[model samples]
Target chain A: MTALLKIDGLRKRFGGNEAVKNVSFEVNPGECVVLAGDNGAGKSTVIKMISGVYQPTDGKVYMNGALLTGKTPEAVRTAGIETIYQDLALADNLDPGLNLYLGREAVKHVLRFPYLDRKKMREDAAKVMLSLGIVVPDPAAPVREMSGGQRQAIAIARAIHWQAGIVIMDEPTAALGVPEQREVMALIERLKKQGVGIILISHNLPDIFAAADRIIVLARGVVAGERRPAETNDEEIVRMMMGATL
Target chain B: MTDNTVNGSNTNTKPGGTSFVRSLLNAWSWLFLILILGFFEIYAQTQTGSTLLFRIYNLQAISIAASQILLLGLGLTLVIVAGHIDLSIAFSTGFAAVVMALIIRTAGADAGWVTVILAMLAGLGAAALVGAVNGWLVAILNVPSFIGTLGTYGIARGAALIVAGGATVSIRNDHTRAFGNGDILGLPVPLVVAAVLTLICHYLLKHTRFGAHTYALGANRASVERAGVNVKKHLILLFILSAFTAGIGGLIYTSRFSAGAANAGEPILLYAVAAVFIGGASLTGGQGTITGTVIGAFIIAVIQFGLVFCGLPPYWQFVAVGLVIIVAVLVDQSKDRLMGGKS
Candidate 1:
């Protein structure tokens, strides 16, 4: 089957240095593709380009073969792609329900002006959290009050709830503990069963093997190697990451 | 679940969760507000030899004063929540007052209430224009909101002065005067307007997508932008809302006074900022509430009026307001730390 999301020869140049140079990748439906690289391997740059966080010097991102022409992040979202950065960006002052529906709020007609359908939005927020099995201390509490793992779950749930066709996770479990990491892994498994394409970037080898069906290694803004988890071991992947011959 | 340090306190003390007392302690702002009202009410009871603050008689007078500053505080809350501060709100309101007065003066006679409505629209339009410039300067040109709106303060003050020709424009129109100083049933028109506006704003801030985005923009601009929301457009709209609301407040103010002058809004501008800050709105942005602002505004009005009831000089009233602002801010910080930066 053709890839649900395709990044064609993605190139990004910041001044004189090419952060991401001629990188190409594809993620088929329900497949998890890992970008394994050391620091400065252009993994972040490539991910940002695909997510429309950065304007590619030269590249084209496609969702199911349809060109996502607009450079704005909203445009990329409209094309059915969502990204979860390492920061797990959430508005700390707002409640869980408010943060979940930040830009897309439920509204009911009131005479002429459209008033917020707060009841509906709050109900939906609770529903989505339950559906994803994300347990938090209080959904009504501010996000700043949440732990790292809970925040991560909320971020992932936000992207998925948007019905995104492709989900890009940048080190989804980097700062999380073992249990939290396991929770994120279970979430990834659930997404895979739902037939959603995933592009995961990580330096954690175990996480890579656990979630990824295929791994693409990049060094110095270029693809170095590609392998299946069954076909390669951690030692080989480490050598590839260090620019040593496989 | 194993970490005691995670919540600083046990989050799951009971299946029903933390007791009502614990919940109240966490909401320190409300506690502070109730204490303020209680102290003032007691003071009034002793001074006047009767319990009278909550009575409909005193509420009319307090609300009139509260309503004037309430609009200003509400605007600042929105601007601050969206990561912007509008220093020019007071002068913008003055400019709007002048705009309304000018329309009334020109309408002469035979224009009826139609002229009053037209003037209100024109005032609003001028206010929106002022807001647009602030938005453009800050959002598009990258000028800091503090500096951008500071410049507007001078512009609006000057524009008001120029339009009024350095003299107070007496509003001859009965309808225009009624809008400011008249009554709706038993309540003052200004008080009723304030009540309606406060309800609408409370709903908007709590329930709307725009309000949610405003909170996000203040918290983390990059995050919201990446989430596919239009950051620039949202910021611009927020500033516009701030200025536009200030302008409406100005119109009502001019109507009540039966005249519009450049210096009319001068006295209340600083108090407006103080009201929002006292309401627990952060100067750095990311958090605020309309309900808090309403109460904050009433606190100011009560203090200002209470001083008079105590037979204190005007300077004492000024000192009291300043002190209350400082104390309220201190409470705001203490509350935040108590809640472990939940604010």
Candidate 2:
């Protein structure tokens, strides 16, 4: 199958330091590719380049055979690549409906003047959340009032509602509880079932082993190795994460 | 991890009693306004042998005072809601007023409606220029809004003074004066303008996509940017909107008083800021409403007018307003805590 996303020899240099060097990967549709690494192993830099937060010094990213390198973060999102940062990046002061459509709000016309179509947005948000199996008791309440899992669900729902072809989650379950973590893992399974491509960045080995179809370990600024979960154990992956020879 | 029970247990854990208290706390500012009005009405009846609330003249005076502060506070409310400040508005108002008055003075006091309209646009443009500078300094240059606006405040104040040649530029336009002071459908023209502007701003802040992004911008700017928003452009527009409203204040100042001093908006700046805070906007941003700001403006106006009507010295108005602002903030903090702590 054609790759849903392809990172062609991605390389990033910050001043004299090479952050991500000669890293390449491809994510096929319906695949969960987890990027695992120790802190400062250039996992973030690689994703940042792919998400358009940072322009690659020498590399290219493609979404469905279209060049995505050098695009602005907003442009990247419009091109169907959604990145859910570790913080969830939610406006805590707004309701789920508003948060779901933060920059691109739904508008209706009254007397030829455009106004927020809040009812439509709210109903749509409700439908999306319900489909995600996330029950928000008060749709009008700000997301800040929600539990951690609910907020995570909202972030995921936002991406899904936008019909994002590729979703990059950075430590999505890091701040969640055990149950919430399970919920998030379940969400990953659902997304995979929907044929959406996912690039998950994580530190938790159990989470990586559980959610990843293929684990790509990063050591320093380069790809250490890649393995199918069925073919590798935590011990070997940990060695690869430590810059061991594949 | 059944999907059916996801977050359902914790969601219902918020007791109804606490939520009731939270709602009441949210309306604390309104309650405070009514309480002050009641106190003033009682004082007018018992001390002055007159009814305060029942008198149209007193109501008109109070509302007119509120209308002035509200004009300045309206756009500032959005700025504050978006987690920024525009201190230069004090002088932006003065600058616009002086520029308008200068144009009118040069065009001749009886320079007809066309000249007056052009002058108003020029005035608004001057204020918007100040706002753009503020946006550039804060948004693009990454200057903290407080410091950036404060710098613009000094620059605008000096510019207004220099433009006015260091004195109030007074004019005598019969049409301008009538528009400033005349009644529209039984409402004072200034009050009418303020009311109409208030409705428009309320709509902009409450019912538009721009407003939604504004709230999101304040709450989490990264969220807005990641969601494909041009945050810099939005910031620039927000500052311009702020200056635009303050410019309207300046235009009214020139027309209503027949003079546009460099310090025209200086005295009202404090009241405008107070109204915003009293309206429940936090310094940290991401919380507030236009309705709350309107009520806040009225609260300040009523206290200022009521104190004088009850024979208190004018300086007492300052002290009283200061005390009320403190109380409002304290109430706001308590409300946040009541709502299970700040988010």
Candidate 3:
């Protein structure tokens, strides 16, 4: 089958330095692909271009053989590409339901006026959490009241419910405790089984090995190498990321 | 589950009365309570009427004042929530009203409703245009909203003065005057308009994509932009909302006075700002609701009416209002600190 999502010859520049230089990759459906790189690597820049946060200086993005480059963020979302940022992009003051349904609120007719379907939205939010095996006291609870793991889970649920074909998460397990990390790992596995393609940006070798079906390593805005997790060990992967011969 | 540090307090509290209290504190409910108590005491002593009934009786009066403030506050709330302030709403309202009067005279009596509608539209259009300029200056040119709106404050006030010719334009038409004096279901027409506007605004702010986008833009523009939202577009729309609401307020003012004056809305600004701030809206933006603003508007109105009913000097009303505003804000902050920012 054709790649579900493909990036070809992506290059980005800021002032004098090249942030992402002619990187290309493909992710098949239901594949959990990890983009592994160090602090100065161009992983984020590439992801940004793919998610329509920033247009590439030069590149073509294809979603199931359809060109998707240069589209607006809302358009990208409609095309089934969802991105979960490092901060999770949640409204702390709003309840879980409102946050989950943010910008995509459901409307009901009330005497010829459009009123929000708050009850339906709240119910959907609960169902989303329940499907993720996450429990909360109430769907109406403010996100600020939730723990880090719960917040991450809620973000994942948000993307999942939106029916994203490709979900790109930036450090989903960062700052999370071991149990929380485990919870997220399980969620990732579940997404793969559900036929959702995932791009996980991470630095942890153990996590990449544990969760990623394939790994794409980036160095100085270039794809250093690619590997299948079953065939490669941690040392070789680290060497590939660091651009060193061992 | 292994990390107990996540639930160190183990406070799986089901949002008890304390949460309600917290909401009230954030909502500036104490100020309203004090105003009610003071009114009850003074109305009891001065009048031979039932104090309870009198308080209920004054709801119309309070509603009148609250509606005005609510109209202005709704506009300002959007600006504030987007991490900006619009101090020109008072002058904008005044100018809009003055323009309405001019339109009425030009359009003739036969075109009364047309004049009213056009005037309201013109006022809103003018204010929104000005607001768009304000956003452009702030978002594109990098000027602060305080300064931009303050500058527009003078400009709007001058336009009002010019339109009114430094005098109140009194309405002689009985039909037009009826709009101000008429009651609908025991409520003043202005109050009814205000109530409807508030409900619509409450829904818009709580349930629309625009509302969510505004909150996102206010809290963190960079993150919101990264998430693919057009930050500048939302900012412009928010400012437009603020100015348009103020324009609506101008219509109400003209109807209430049966005249349009250049300086009519001068005192309304302080009260509107106070209401938004007192109702848990932060100057820092990303917080506040139309519901909170409605309550805040009524709280201010009740206090003002209470002082007058209590046989206090009119000037003392300002002092009492100022005190309540300061105290309510202090309590709001204290409550936030008490909640340890989890709120």
- B60-157 in candidate 3: lDDT tens per residue? 78778888888889978877877799888878788878877777656666556767777667766766766777777777777888998898889888
State which candidate has the highest DockQ: 2
* Window of ten residues with lowest summed lDDT in model 3 chain B: B1-10
In model 1 chain B, the worst 10-residue window by lDDT is B3-12
DockQ, per model, reads 0.36, 0.59, 0.21
Give the top-scoring candidate (lDDT): 2
| Per-model TM values vs. the true structure | 0.87, 0.95, 0.85
Global local distance difference test of model 2: 0.90
Tens digits of lDDT, candidate 3, A85-118: 8888887666677677776767788888777677
Go through the candidates in order and give each one's C-alpha lDDT.
0.79, 0.90, 0.78
For DockQ, candidate 2 versus 3, the one ahead is: 2
Q: Residue B46 in candidate 1 has what lDDT?
A: 79
lDDT of 2 at B109: 66
